[model samples]
Target: MKKRAAFLIGTGCVLIAVSASLAVNNQLESLKAEKSAELLTEAFISRTTVFETSVTEMTNEPVPEIIADNEIRGADEQASAKKPIIIDGQEFIGLLSIPSLGVSLPVNNDISYPLLKMTPCRYFGSVDSDSLIIAAHNYNSHFGKIGMLKPGDRVNFTNAGGLIETYAIAEVLTLPGDAVDEMIKPEGWALTLFTCTYSGTERITVRCVKEERI
Candidate 1:
């Protein structure tokens, strides 16, 4: 009888352990989902909203007929009568807006070297330069929503000249801290957006292919 009792107690202990483990795993999965959502929200507000607003306002600006028809107008662009409009220097008169990312703000030029806090992703800086790269703060309040964003999403940027630019997401990558090349590729004109992923340990990388130049 004693042996049987011992066996029963051992089985009960095993059952309890199994139950606890399952509970823990479920909790972990739930937590990850929550985090992803938070990240998205933060990105939507800071980056996405700002970009969209900038583009919409720029559209109202008069486009130079010379540059409007020609994508690469060296002399005609500068000679055009119309010019990009901006307020406070902080405002971007000509910018593109991406509806998918909830981004409709002005995009400016920024390089990885001598990094600055605010870099606009829209402008190519020099027309001969490579891609239009930009960065934004990755806040936790977003709950990993930005991290959850996948490649192929639509992105837009406009210039003060009322020229609308469009891009399609090419890559969405995450890398360890201090790693910044995949994000800074010297390829053609690729639009790159990056921020911290999950508490800033991993960097979130976004690459986009320039689709339309109007």
Candidate 2:
């Protein structure tokens, strides 16, 4: 009986140690994500400033004559216009802001495990198509608090071209992590934001629609 008690105690200690270690590791990861997001936001701001300046200078120059219909841009050229903005060796499509959650982060053009650790990434569509989907880790400084947002809350996406699109939260739901088809469906939503639940078994999905401006 004494031997059994000692064995149980040892197991309890091991469990406690593991739990503590995991908590510490999670905190460190959250901090790292927050720092990365801050740096990316700064870079985005600087890039936007330069772009605006360039546009201003071009406005002073004479406008080029329009080409004939047959000489218009090809499909391939039109697609190239939607390419992601490359910044510091990373491809970013835009910046995402959830005013209700007090969250703003740079959005990468593609999603990967490593990229999610740095900032939110485009999970599905494009801003121009009005079917954008974004995914991010559930770090406290990231999309962790997105679930707190309520219907009618404001969300905004500023594309690389400096076009700001506003959206109003329409719905919030949870779907299984494997519900890829359902999550990416663009039939109704203009923008979708999702993050894994704390348990990582499910996703917290937020759906938003474009807010018409007067």
In the range 25-111, model 1's lDDT, one tens digit per residue, is 746654553353333323433433223343342334433454355446556553431243433343332343445545343333333
Q: Give the C-alpha lDDT of model 1.
A: 0.49
| Residue 124 lDDT (model 1) | 33
Model 2: CA > 4 A from native: 50-83
Candidate lDDT scores, in order, read 0.49, 0.77
Between which residue pairs do clashes occur in model 2? Answer: none
Error of 2 at 55 (Å): 19
Q: Once model 1 is optimally superposed onto the true structure by TM-score, how far is the C-alpha of residue 24 displaced, in angstroms?
A: 29
